[model samples]
Target: MQETNDADTTPTHVETAADLDARIDAADRLLVEFYTDGCGACAAMEPILGVVARETGVPVVTVNPRDDPALIDEYRIESVPTLLLFEDGDPVRRLADGFVGAERVIDFLA
Candidate 1:
């Protein structure tokens, strides 16, 4: 039987700009979520992202720009719950529609 509640399924949090760079550099392909506190849509994505990470075998990470404001400007974020797909340490695609399901998130990565 396979365990379904492993901590690895959960998305890691990026605390700083450097941390974000390091994570993006470490993974060949990564899904980075830009979210802010008190965001209902952002809160809804947590479980979906975990499922996305586990099902797609892609590492997912979340960063609240409030912790490091530079991330907001660096990523050119215009709203909360923006999903960015990074490949080879560069952002290749962006999905900022907000409150997407697991299938949509996985499709975005593809």
Candidate 2:
């Protein structure tokens, strides 16, 4: 029997601390969103992030700090809807000013 993946074809792009390192390392430039459940601002950023991913051609991934508390300290995530841009496995920019428009995100990527 051929091996198969049951996961959806459309990428959810959610990452955990365990695999985050490898994921960022593989991408030339990757966007990571840190969020928590029950956050209104975080919820609002969903559509914006989707737009950023599509418009900028960057692989956007979400990581819930609650799943791995160390991520909070590691990334210095003081708030939800925080977006960090990693280039060559190193974080070079961060957007943690709460919900922002798609244009802002695209500019940040640039």
Candidate 3:
């Protein structure tokens, strides 16, 4: 298995659907943002997610569902900037509103 530095606060980019599954399995609690390129709200959330990761010690990841068509269908992601909270490898919460602030993100994780 590849060694991962759990202390890293940078949001991970999930390139493929399988990689997304692997990441979720690896982390005890994970926040995944499904975003598309050229999306303003998605771009806006980048720094906010970074801060959330740093403040809460929760691993945050971003995935472009367009890169994996199956992911779009599997997650039923209808919009960019959809946030999914996964705990113990199962999805427990979803926040699909656009351009959510760091406070709301932190509260969702909490």
Candidate 4:
């Protein structure tokens, strides 16, 4: 089940807290990101993650922490570009603070 959005090749927008839980229930893999608009780290992370998402066939949702108030509080994300990889609703990998690089992301996925 592949979906498309302007954001990514297979993008799933998680705008609300309930959307998050619902998505987790239905998807096998979820790449959830907490990003801020003006953050350098978040900007760098997006394209790297875009490639990773396309290559791995993963569903990705990039959320703006500033806008998603509930999500910001729920995840306790202190920094921009916090990535959480979930397998069957369970967290498999978490890259907090910011995105490192494609290689690191690929290594984490592997």
Q: lDDT: which candidate is best? A: 3
CA lDDT, every model vs. true structure = 0.90, 0.80, 0.91, 0.75
Mind giving the per-residue lDDT tens digits that candidate 2 earns over 20-66?
Answer: 88778777878888999999988888888776776667777788888
Clashes of each: 0, 0, 0, 0
Q: Estimate, for each residue in 1-110, the C-alpha lDDT of model 1 and write its tens digit.
A: 22434544679998899999999999888899999999999999999999998887788999999899999999999998999999999999999998999999988988
lDDT over C-alpha atoms for residue 6 of model 4? 44
TM-score of each: 0.91, 0.86, 0.92, 0.78
* Model 3 global lDDT (CA atoms, 0 to 1): 0.91
- Model 4 pairs in collision: none
Sequence-dependent TM-score of model 2: 0.86
34-100 in candidate 4: lDDT tens per residue?
8878888887887788777776667787778667587777777877778888899887788885658
Which residue ranges in model 2 land beyond 4 Å of their true spot? 1-15
RMSD of each: 2.9, 6.0, 4.0, 3.5
Task: Point out the higher-scoring one by TM-score: 1 or 3.
Answer: 3
**lDDT (Cα, tens digit) per residue for candidate 3, span 1-110:** 22335554789898899999999999899999999999999999999999888888888989999999899999889988999999999999999989989999999988
- Ranked by lDDT, top first: 3, 1, 2, 4
List clashing residue pairs in candidate 1: none
Superposition TM-score, candidate 4 onto the true structure:
0.78
